[model samples]
Target: MEVKGKVVVVIGAGKSGMAAAQFLASHGSRVYLNDIKTRENLEERSLHNLEKMGITLLLGAHGDIAGLQPDLVIVSPGVPLTIPPVAEARERNIPVWSEMELASRFTKAPMVVVTGTNGKTTTTALIGQIMEDAGFKTFVGGNIGVPFISEAEQLQPQDVAILEASSFQLETTESFKPFISLILNITPDHIDWHGSLEGYIKAKAKIFARQDEKDWLILNGDDRETRALAGLAKAKVLFFSRKHILEEGICVENGYLVVKLEGKTVPVIKPEEIFIKGSHNLENALAAVGAGWLMGVSAESLERSLRTFPGVPHRLEPVLNIDGVRYINDSKGTNPDASIKALEAYPDPIILIAGGKSKGSDFTSFAEMIKDRVKALVLVGQAAGEIEEAVKKTGYYNYYRVETFKDAVYKARDLANQGDIVLLSPACASFDMFRSYEHRGEVFKELVHELAKND
Candidate 1:
């Protein structure tokens, strides 16, 4: 786990790659950063951040395995294992790990890691907020932004680190056990990288691989996929359920978020008190409550945190209520199940914007939610036609489709009545249009503002 004075080769040069290189170099490792981006593009703000960290840049080029004998090679979540240098690294028997793994090994700090196909952002933010309110110095990032290892040396043991761990980051991790770890739920996602549903599940289960009996593992009792993997964790398993009521697991009992353990019913908080909405949000809240309880956060603090917490952006985030028309930016809905949850969050007639880079979700089920709530479909990005075709095959036709995000919003403005909800819940990835989901969501917000100003 030690990287001191080691020659480390960092791959990808994206957000994670840059952070890993800097984190390794800061700890006295000589880090070489590699990316396929052109020298001109490498001058962007993202890579520029790494230059000051003293990493040797290998931009406009691949990581040359022959030139540098690296003690460690770090790969980003988005990087493929099939990439030439990565394959070469494997052939050389060079140790490869993720930014999260490297960070965990260096930090003496205790962490509460949240990983799930959905709700990771909300749960991670919620845990950090609760711990921070309880007077813990909190470092809240990982897959969210700025890996904890990048700042762990500056943080004390009394400080808490809450990470939004992703399946990709967990894939290459070694010895990255959290003090408290929770897998919220697993649904079919990232089929593009994983190549199958089973592969994706395998990647997510890696989060619990490094835990010990003394450590605690929380799981989604509601998700069968997550529940099936609970037996593998060396840590004690605690669950939060929206499906089955348990004698000990977190459940909605008597309108309270109840955590019953050892015949004692403790009220962690209330579901309605949470700022977020829908059954999914309820599950997300309960999961956070369970994590909070495991971390020794008192019920009172959790209740207060629930009322005070502002939910994470782009997951059913209400942007504006213009003339009684509520527009929600759920650009975080990068998969079909996530979009379905966003749709269920509101009953208002939805002018649904639902398309992007399709992530192999069977969009046929979208008809059930769309038929009941959607007034019109405003589609964008590469998967627009595919989403529209699914609407047709599901017998919910007559939905409109627009090509660009701006056009989608404009048509939604026309189709939406004063009481309607215009929601951008693309059930696919955002790479076809925007840099990231956040970028796509920001554009949606800006266009909404522009429309309002003209009105």
Candidate 2:
């Protein structure tokens, strides 16, 4: 935790890395920020600002890690551990910590961390709201837009730090233990980055690596992969399920979200009363309620937050209803499983906009669901052909392959009827066409708004 005079190397000049560099420099650590990208690829102002703070910028290559002889290495979530510099640091026995790991060392606050293949953002945000509504000073960050290090140092013991941990971040974690941890659900995702499905699951399991009996670990009881990891936690394990009633833990029973712990059944809220719809969102709400309850949040506060929280922006967010046709933006559905859940949320005829940068996901199941749920499919980006092929194998031919993102939206609009839903759930990543999933959702919303004006 003492970085007063240590030489530190922060890898990947992204948001998390920049925060880490600035944080370290402010704390008197001699920081060197490195990236595989050249100086031209990054923003000029950000680079100059880092230099102004006395943090050294090492761009273009990572070979400088050896020459700098850093005592500690901080890794951004997006940077793979197989990178030469990271492996070299391990080989040389230099301490390597994730940005989350580095951030956790500075905070004495009770942390509530959420991790899984899906629903992490919504679950984390919901938990933050519940804590805040309960009158607790809360800081919410991590993989959910803001870096944890940016707010970690400022969190007091009485404050709460609610973080959304990604597999990428958890894989590099050393001493990042949360007071409460929730594994919402695990599925095959980010295989290209994690090397395999088993590897991805291992990274997710790291969320509870350092927790003890004092901590609480929550798992999704409905998810097979997540339920199988119950024995790995050293902390007390709690399960949340939407499909089954549990003897202990949170679950939906007889139209109510209830927590049954220690032979006491506490009815929290009704699923119909929650602002966020869908089985996945219901599961997220259950996990949030469990975390909030474990952290001493009142039942009234949890229900109030769940009733009013308007869900995350990019996940099944309602955009506009033009001519009785609902247009939805679910751009955060970056995997086939997420898109499948999005499809399951609605019963209306759907004109689904899918296909983006493939994350090595098997689309056969997604394609099968599209055959039954989707009225029409408009595909775009790098994975169009692959998705189309999968759909074809399922004997679903009501699909159009568009050349551009704008065209895909326009085509979906044309195909949708007044009673139908036009949904933007890519089921893949957005890096093929846009900067990030947020950018992709913003553009979809803008296009939908523009279409309304034109109509």
Candidate 3:
């Protein structure tokens, strides 16, 4: 933990890496910030600012780690350990730590870590809000938006660090333990990045890897993959399910978010009172409520926070209504399971705008899953042909293929009838044609607003 004057190499000058560099430099560490992209591709102002802080920027290539003889190497979530520089550093016995790991060494606050394929953002944000409303100083970040390193040094003992941990972030983490850990649900995602489903699951399981019996692990009882992970955790296990009442943990019983702990049943809140829509969101609510209860947050505070959290944008946010047609932007549905849940949220006939950069997901069943609910399907991005093939197998002919976001949005609008919903729930990542899912959702909203102007 003594970082002063120690040489450290930080990889990938993205948000996490940049924050890690800034933090290390502030702590008096000699930090070399590296990114794969050349200096020409980067903003000169940002690099100059880092240079002013005594942090060196090594752009275009991961420069000479062995030559630098650094005391430690810090990696961003986007860069895998399999990369030559990181792998070489490992062989040389230099400690290669993730931003999460380094930040945890400085953070004095008790952490609440949330991980899952679908609901991590919603659950993490809700838990952070619940704690804040209960009058605790809370820092919410990790995979959601802000980097944990950015706020680690300022965290107080009484503060709560709520992190939305992802598989990528968890991969390089070693000693990043949390007071409470919640795994919302595990489904196959990031297959290309992880190389396999099992690899992805192993990375996510690391969220509870360093915990002892004193810590708590909240899991999804309904998901076989998440439920199966209970046996691996040394921490106390609690479950949240939507299907059946559990002997312990939280579940939906007669439309209320109820908890059964120590053989006593307690009602948290009615599902109707939860501001977020869908059964998937109900599952998220149960997880947050259970975590809050464990932290001794009053039931009243939990209910109030759940009813007013206002949901994370791009995760099934309704943008604008053109005439009677409703447009929903679920751009956060970056995998098949998430999109499947988005489809389940609507009862009205849907004109779904889907497909993006493929995540090696099997869209074979995607079309079948939405055959009854989706009136028309508009495909975009790299996976359009793959999705078209899947739709053909379902014998659903009302599908269109478009090349860009503009085409997809207009096509969906044209296909949607009065009282119908046009959902932008791409069952893939946004990297093919857009920068991020937020960018894709913004474009969809802009197009929808244009339609409104025309009306």
Candidate 4:
């Protein structure tokens, strides 16, 4: 772990790269940050900040990597292994690690890593809060908008790191084993980025790849893809289910969340006690309870955290209720299955705002869900036509296509009635209209607030 004079190269100048470069540079490692983006594309302030930290920059190209002769290379989650620089590093036999893998070497804290197609953020945040309520020092990060490397140096042996790892992050990781690894569910998502659905599953499976008998793998019992992974996991696998009563993991029984380990059963909390809506959110809470128990959190503390946690934004978040109409910003529903779950959360008539950059997802299931739940559909972004085609097949004609995001919001408001929910749960990525799902959700909240003020 000593990096006193070692030459290290950090790939991708995004958040993960910035934190990794800063960590290595501060630790006396000669750090080189290589990014595909030019200086003009990056923010001036961020560039100056990295320079102040004494990290050398290799921007706009990957040609300089061969000359660097790095002793080690750390890649950001977004940087794929297929990239030339990373492949070149592999060819040179230079030790390559993901930012999380490198961060794990610096901290002795036990990690609870959560990864799945959806519900990762909510589950990770819930587990972190559960640990905090149980009086444990916890650092929450990874794919939840904060890089683990940023807090790696400050961790103590008694602490725990709750990470919301993504498939992109897991693909680059080698030695990133967690004490408790949870896979909520797996469905077709990010196929465009991972090249294929099988490829995406392989990357997600990496989260528990290095785990052994001592560690725990909490998997979703109801999800077919997740259930199939039990055979591959080397660690002791536990299941969490929303449908059936689990014999050895976590599940809901007779309206209460319960843990059944060995021959004993302990109830955690009722589904109604959780502040978050939706059966899917309940499943997230179930997974968190499994992870919390593995981390030695008391049942009382787990129930307390479940009841108090208000849930994360961009995932079925209620912005404001105006004139009996609820505005929900589920902008994090970036895939067909996620949007389908969002639709199932409400029984009220819905004016659903959907469509964005398509990830090559099948819209048949999403359209079927909408046909029953959605009263009116407002479509925007690049995938409008594809979604429209899918909806038309269901004979749901109460749909409108908008050229702009703002127009879609206004149109949904105009089309909605009292007691109806205006849900912005796009079944596509936000890259076509915004920087990210968070950005898209923020914009939706602002627009809803503005509409409320006018009323």
Candidate 5:
């Protein structure tokens, strides 16, 4: 488990890969970094970090992964193990791992690990805030843009860290266990990376893979995928659900959010008290409350945080209300299920903006929900024609296909009338038109602002 001063070869010179290489080198390890691109094609800034650590670089695809004789192979989440060199390394019994796993082995701090197909960011951020409010020194990072090794050695057991774990990281980790593990829900996500729905679910289950019988493992009891796999957990089982009440967990009943713990009914807050206005977010709060319960945080603090937390952007973010038609940016709805949830949260007739890079998700089920709820559908990005076809297949004809987020927004605005909602809930990836879902959401917001100014 001791990775320090060992021979470490980090595959893929991406953000997490560079962070891992630099951190390993700083700990006296001779690091070897590799990337798919040639040296000249590499961005100068990333290479500079490795240079500062004095690590050796191997550019282009040709790598002696098996020849390095490295003690550990740090595989970036973006790198597939099926890559010939990496597979060859594994064949030689060279241990492979994620940066998160390698970084965690060096830390003694207690952690709150959060993983899901979605809501990982919001739930992790909420857990971090709750831990901080409980007077614990908190480190918030993992899959959410921060590497674990960067801060692991500096942490104490008194410190509480929240990690947003991804399936890619979970699949490679051997010792990436945590004191409190939260599996929000398992929906079909990252199928491209995981290769199948079953593979993805098994990856998410690894969040509890390393925990002991005493550790706290939180889950979503309502999700069939998560609930069906609960028996695989070694740790104590705790859950968040909307279906039924538990002696110890969070739930919704009679339109109220209740915390049932140790024969006590504690009301952290009601469903309506939550600032986040979607069904998925309500489930996210339940997961956060479950994390808080284990941290010994008072229900009062959980209630305050739930009501005060404004919510993360690109997940049903409301931009402006123009002429009684509210515009919502839900670019984070990168799957059919996620977009279906967003559509379900609305009561008013919706002028929906949907489409992006399809992840092999069937938008058919969502069309049923959209058909009844949507006033008009403005499609764009890679999946526009497919989504339009999907909507039509549902026997619903109110749809349009346009290019660009701005054009989509304008078309939605024109189609939207008083008391209607304009929603940018693309049920696909953003690679076709934007750098990311955040970029898509930002463009949606900017265009909404422009329209507001004109009105």
Candidate 6:
């Protein structure tokens, strides 16, 4: 882990990559930060700051790792390993590590890593809150915004690091093993990046690949793909389910969130009492409860956190009610399955704002759900035509396609009637229209608030 005066190459100029480069340079590594994007395409302030810090910037093309002969390469999660420079590094026997892996090498804290297709953010945040309420110092970051490397060196052994491990982050891990690894549920997502569903699942499995008997792996018993991974885990497996009562994991029993593990039954809280609603959030709560209980958190602390956790901003978040029509921001629904879950959360007739950058997701199921639940659909961004076709194939013709994101929001508002819901739950990535899902959600909220001003 000592990197004094070693040549290191860091790929991607995004948040994680910049953080990794800064961290490595501060540790006295000769760092070369590279990105295929030109300096014009990236954040000028951040790139200028990196250059000022003495880290060499290689923009507009991939870095020549073979020419540099670096000791190690740290890759941002968004950069695929198949990129020539990374692959070349591997061919030359250079150690390639993910930002998550590199960060782990510097931290002594017991890590609680959460990974899955849909609920990782909510579950990771909840676990951090629960641990903090139980009097443990916590550092929460990974894919949830801040890079783990930014805070890795600051954590002590008694502190806990709650991380949201994405498939992209887990795939490049070499020795990154969390003390507690939770797989919320596995669904078809990021297929374009991983090449296939199997490949994505394989990446997610890396979260616990290095764990031994003393560690824990939490799975969702309700998901077949997630449950099947239990046989492959060397760590002790714990399952959380929303569909059925589990004999030895976490589940709902008699309207209460219950945990039956290690020959003990602990009723955590009532589902209705929890701040976040929806069946998906219930599963997230069960997983968070498992992490907290396993960490020896008191039932009182768990209940307090669960009751007060106001839920994440972009997932099923309420914006404002305009003339009895509620507007919801679920911009984190970056895939069809996530949007489907968002659709299921509401019983009101919906004017759904969907469509963004395609992620190779099949929209038939999402379309079917919309046919049953949505009163009207307002599509925008890159995948609008595809989603509209899928909706048409489902025999649901109450749909409109818009050119701009603002237009889509205004159209949804116009279509929504009293007691109806206007939901911004695009079933695709937000890169086509905004910087990220958070940006997309923020714009949606602003537009909704603008509508409220006129009301």
TM-score per candidate: 0.96, 0.98, 0.98, 0.97, 0.94, 0.98
Global lDDT of each candidate? 0.84, 0.93, 0.90, 0.91, 0.85, 0.93
Of 4 and 6, the candidate ranking higher by lDDT? 6
Which portions of model 2 show Cα errors greater than 4 Å?
none
Worst 10 residues of 2 by lDDT: 59-68
Top-down TM-score ranking: 2, 6, 3, 4, 1, 5
Cα displacement (Å) at residue 452, model 2: 1.5
Runs in model 6 with CA error above 4 Å? none
Candidate 2 TM-score to native: 0.98
Lowest lDDT block of 10, candidate 4: 77-86
Model 3, position 376: C-alpha lDDT score: 90
Per-residue CA lDDT of candidate 3, range 1-455, in tens?
79999999999888888888988898899999989899888778888889999998888777676799999999887687888889999999899988999999998999999999999998999898999999999999998789999998799988899999899889888789999999998888999889999999999999999999999999999999999999999999999889988878899787788888998888878999899989999988899998899888988888899889899999999898888999999999999899999999989999999999999998876788768678999998899999988888888888999878899899888888899999999999999998788998898888889989987
- How do the residues 292-342 of candidate 2 rate in per-residue lDDT, one tens digit apiece? 999888788889999999899999999999898999999999999999999
Given candidate 4, what's the lDDT at residue 159?
A: 95
Q: How do the residues 332-403 of candidate 4 rate in per-residue lDDT, one tens digit apiece?
A: 999999999999999999999999999989999999999988999999999999999999999989999999
Model 1: lDDT to the true structure = 0.84
Per-residue lDDT tens digits of candidate 6, residues 1-455?
A: 68889999999898899999999989999999999999999999998888888999999999567799999999998888888999999998899888999999999999999999999999999999999889999999999879999999999999999999999899888989899999988889989999999999999999999999999999999999999999999999999888998889998888889889878888889999999999899989999999999999988889999999989989999999999999999999999999999999988898999999999999989999999999999999999999999999989999999999999989998898999999999999999989899999999999999999977
Winner on TM-score between 1 and 5 is 1
Against the true structure, candidate 2 has what lDDT? Answer: 0.93
Candidate 1 runs further than 4 Å off? 44-54
TM-score of 4: 0.97
- Cα displacement (angstroms), candidate 6, residue 220, comes to 0.2
Q: Where is model 3 more than 4 Å wrong at Cα?
A: none
